[model samples]
Target: MYNKRFIIPGLVIFVLFVTFPLWFNAFSTASPVPKPELPPGGEKECVAPASEMRDRHMVLLNEWRDGVLRDGERDVITVGGKQYRKGLQMACMQCHTSKEKFCDTCHDYTSVNPFCWDCHLTPEEAALKKETH
Candidate 1:
């Protein structure tokens, strides 16, 4: 055990370095969970409830995309007395008009880049496209 003291200190230093992030994060106060801006005009209802949509909106969107594109189920759905066509730009964007205010808040906070933008243009983008063309 000639190098016992050096080995022990080195092991302790290595463990501290390895676990520093965990312990530091445990003590540091995290930023508040993002509250995405609600839709304007006091529109409170969605095709589904808020809690369900919050958790599963992506799943619902994927289903809608598949149904519309793959299965050719271009049907309108009625929820809460309002009829909505089965598409993102047709339905969701109608209410959640400002992608920055409504969608970007949560998406940015969660560090996600949803693939929705790959196909569907934002209102700003649409406007720019209109001007260009």
Candidate 2:
């Protein structure tokens, strides 16, 4: 036995709920793409190549974290014959200063909540919060 009358309403309710989050997110204001500023010399190159960094940053960070915490390593990474520190605060955040402008833009766009921010604060974000009365 089939109830065609009930089927249509049930499907409509299911679809509405299923798509509601996507619909609401789409209509919400989107943050602009991040344009991270370089340091005083206007140095443009990253320690690793840009394409590799774009795809493998998380992997590199995880490796660095493990090397530091688990192995008790001093966390020096050599890339392209140059040495660099492995800490996000030391290396990465030097360029990607504003987490709101840089990290949050892409994370929000992709709907990802990275654990990085939970443990670390960008230098710009370290400022004291203004209290409201």
Q: Provide TM-scores for the models.
A: 0.77, 0.69
Residue-by-residue lDDT tens digits, candidate 2, 1-133: 3997999899999998999988897999866665544444354777778789879988988888888778888766664455668788777766666677666766776788889878886676665432221
Best by TM-score: 1
Candidate 2, residue 127: CA error in Å?
5.1
Where in model 1 is the C-alpha error above 4 Å? Answer: 1-13, 20-32
Each prediction's whole-model lDDT (CA):
0.88, 0.73
Query: Cα RMSD to native, each candidate?
Result: 3.1, 4.9
